[model samples]
Target chain A: MKKSFAILATTATLACVLANGTAQAGATLDAVKKKGFIQCGVSDGLPGFSYADDKGKFSGIDVDVCRAAAAALFGDAGKVKYTPLTAKERFTALQSGEIDVLSRNTTWTSTRDSALGLNFTGITYYDGQGFMVNKKLGVKSAKELDGATVCIQAGTTTELNLSDYFRANNMKYTPVTYDKSDESAKSLETGRCDVLTSDQSQLYAQRIKLATPDDFVVLPEVISKEPLGPAVRHGDDEWFDIVKWTLFAMVNTEEMGIDSKNVDEKLKSDNPDVKRLLGVEGDKGKDLGLPNDWVVQIVKQVGNYGEVFERNVGQGSPLKIERGLNALWSQGGLQYAPPVR
Target chain B: MADQQGGVAKPPFWNDPTIRSVAFQIIALCVVVGIGYYLFHNTQTNLQQRGIASGFGFLQNPAGFGIIQHLIPYNESDTYGRVFVVGLLNTLLVSVLGILLATFLGFVIGVARLSRNWLVAKLAMVYIEIFRNIPLLLQIFFWYFAVLRNVPSPRQSLELGDAVFLNIRGFYLPAPVFQPGFWVVPLTLLVGVIATVVVRRWAHRRQEMTGQPFHAFYAGLGLMLGLPLLAFALAGFPLAWDYPVLQGFNFQGGFVIIPELAALLFALSIYTAAFIAEIVRSGIQAVSHGQTEAAYSLGLKPGQTLRLVIIPQAMRVIIPPLTSQYLNLAKNSSLAAAIAYPDLVSIFAGTVLNQTGQAIEVIAMTMAVYLTVSLSISLLMNWYNRRAALMER
Candidate 1:
């Protein structure tokens, strides 16, 4: 009787394992395609990058990328589910398949690329660590901040860079660390620290929170290069390629003078690169295992990269960050996408 | 007839009815182990497929970050292991301080709740209810945002004499600076503690033999204080304090308790104290009214009755829940992440997790640290409770 019971339990376990193993692994992609939506991870509440509105509607430059991806796949930019993630939970959420893509102004680093099973498709925002001090402090440059108390957000690259910059310059400073960006900025304003340091964009966002915007001035020192970008999980190569090509296509479309407003008319152009991009000449879509008019759908539905950038973070927006490093490669920027062919 | 010998007839090992139960237990254990192994294997495969490493080697790498509040000296060049230690020490510091403050305030409020003064009782009740009902996270935010942020800057800091200053930057006060021979202080403290222990043993033996009270408290006080002072004097007065000086926009020389630590401590203490107040109130109330009346009837004054009779008996009921409150305070210190206090959770779990991208390792380390702290506190409390109970018996 005991022997039979042992045999039965072993059989049951084996059957369960077999059943799970036999299930199709492409269920995630299938569900995404069927629902015609992409669940994207975004910042919980960082202004100028990703933030929820008064009604809790998520919007930002990061949000635009996810929308663009959905538009490239399903021909509708509105078909995106935004999942708000904190700094700690963002990578895990993507790896766990909780979100299809992460466009949360996350920095691209070697560890994340190799150790977190993440693929950073492209750099969206070029930022750097900077400092903001009260104008009344009479501090013109960060070099003058010897023994100054600095309010820094803990668990960020800024903390590391801040230390490196201070140490390299032979300056002494005390850090008052806080977990959240808002708290650190608040502490600095309240005189808990002499200065607040973070990404240059974040510095601008946080400075406005001061009692008077003119009270604080961001020091003109770019401490460290912060190449922020969008990422997807590593296991799904096909999905990774799709997200990567979608971003590249947008930038390429903009560089080739193709845009949402004129994509339909541009299809008749004689320019070979433009024609191929518009699905007039080659099997670019077939090679990528996508529809023949992938770029067309992306441009028409999500607009070109220039449009997305201008609408979210460029001159048309409050942040108004210059497209210096985010400009096309031909325009003396780092944003170079591979050819479609 | 055979059943009558031992109330039952047991068969041989293989054929016994209980054998099936043993077999079932073994099978269940195997199944659980198998499932656990299978899941682990799947996770390993998944991680391997994505080229992600699963290990703890990252702990020894250069941390590349500087810590704000460290008990031990740390630098950006230090390994991540050192940073972990720094974070662990900070967490322990807050937990210890919070426990001390919470217990003190909790006892006061708890005693106040049982006071005859109507106004005092109602005020204690109001405080307990208000703090106990609201979330600790909300309280942390309220203190960090509404209270601490509203303080004036260092240049115009609200000064308390020349020794202490209250500013939004933090509490700037005199830090006890040790001179070259400062090691003598800790040595003195150790000698004092040893002397106190020796005297206590002697007093206990004397009491056992003579059946008389040996004034153990007075004896302990004299030995501990006298020995420490004598050592300090003999050791050439090894310590001096460096008072905080306001220099332009910042305080220099002396230690400044950062606002993050202050806010975290304040929030944790107040929140934990409320629960402790309830525990204290219930503990005191559980002591019979007859006991209080008997003390009064014995010509004891109100304060004396509380100190000598009521509080000691109340402690018997108060200690167990009070232990839990202390543990809660320690665990809640992890919420220091919300305010960026550089606690173990924030530094190790938040920052290290991001830097290394080893979520499982970082989280496991964090959980293990908290677990060890919580367990040690509870274990120590249990020993104290046992001793207290033994004395009562």
Candidate 2:
């Protein structure tokens, strides 16, 4: 009997190993529920993307993604505890299970998705690497900025991109990397470095925080594709589905013209797509192990993708970034979500 | 036989001190092993469950990053293994510079504290009290942000005959573009240095055997300097200066010292020198005053008294504590990460770990490097300590 039981256990383990994606299916979800909150990893400070005020309140597009995930699980956006991480510390924090979802402004890369054992749910923000220079330097183009000292944030894709760009262009540069965005910006402001390079959106976000934002100009050169997204650890398919669908639900609702302020009104709509997205007609959340009103909860709490974007990083906010590539597919943008049903 | 009285008895097995102690050690050993095994097993299981990659395999992967300071040549396409070496070299470079500067400054301030002039001793006292009390990172910020950041931009660089320039970007000095046969200078210098050491040793032996004095300092200095000068003339001046020139955004084709390196070096040396100065002072004071007086009464001048009697005895007290200061300075060099100095902790443990996501392996490797550096320092200092220890025939 003991031998038979051991054999059964070994076969079960083998099955789990074979079906790698289903390994520890509901482990994170159960742990998160038992702890009564989602552990959301975010950036320490990047104004429109993720920043915490002195009151310890976090507000950004990344924070809203975490909030949507929390609302889907616990029906309350407040059921999340934020752990602000530096760029270097974000992935390790997620892998160690110190946080359930890394909603920081982490770029989606092939190496990160495959080798690092992370699954990027979706791209929440589309960005590109760019350069920002002090206007006094008269650096009109990146090509003319060769042999310059550039302050960059450490542990970022921008560093590699900068290196590749310079090497490809046959130009020489000195990269002085900093741990925080503000520090890099400050270096540029203080004349210690000739330019600051980061994602163009981040360059704008960092620009407004400077003492004289108007004195700096972002060079008109988009160097690399940066699809900033949220990521979760590999395995735990059930948890992965829930976090992933949370963002997609927002996108789907936005496509159906449902938002946080109009979510209740939309729940009473007779349109099939709207009803399905609001979780009124279809049990959209059943397979993901969430309640039927999961979509409703998310839409009511964190708003749809366009609403969150506008409020945080888009025209409604200080960053004034246009919803170009991040807009809906029908509007000639890249944010296209699958049908709810 | 008489001492072996019948009334005397051996303790019971439980009460046997040796047996009890051995059993206790065995139990403690099991506990330690059990804890270590549990942690290792737990980590293995967790990593497998998360599908996170583990092991030293990532070191072979491309580092995919550029560093500002690479002591050896480096490229972005270099493997993580090379990044580790580059980072280790930078850390060693800064630590060596800081150690040399701190030792010199510390020795000067230490002796000055014992000067007959009241103002000199008080000023040294103030310096030690102020610098050692503050933190090292703050001083690094002060140097990088407050001081170096205020330097003029490259367009408005302060230049010395256009060969050297000071700018916000960095301190640019003319790089030596070595032509054919420039290696002779360094070769001659090396040979002169070795010859000087041999001559000094011979001079000391002769003085001990026949009480005949030799001016070894003047002779050795002349040999060391004169040989290098002669080699330069014979080599036909096989060196050219690649002076920095104003380019588009910055000076080009020159040797540069980025402010990050300068700030970290200054902060580390100044901060550690304060502690080392106090140690030197205490070590000197630990020697008896009678040693100096005895040398003076034996017809020794003040310089000879210090060189022959006081310093040798003081070194015995100084070496042990000075070893700790050296270790502290080396370990404290990790704070260069705060200001982007491309030290071991920043490049390998910071960017490399982030890129690879192999936290356990990368961190363990970094910690191992620091441990090896500290252990080697302790071993060298202890050897020197033993040599300076008192000996009797």
TM-score of 1: 0.91
Model 1 chain A: worst 10 consecutive residues (lDDT sum): A19-28
Give per-model TM-scores.
0.91, 0.93
DockQ (Cα-based) per candidate? 0.49, 0.37
Of the true interface contacts, what fraction does each candidate have? 0.51, 0.53
Q: Residue-wise lDDT of candidate 1 within B231-318, one digit each (tens)? A: 7788898788888897756777677788789999999999999999999989888889899899999998989888888888888898
Q: How displaced is residue A193 in candidate 1, in Å?
A: 2.8
Interface RMSD for candidates 1 onward, in order: 3.5, 7.0
TM-score of chain B of each: 0.88, 0.95
lDDT for residue A249 in candidate 1, whole number 0-100: 92
What clash count goes with each model?
Answer: 6, 0
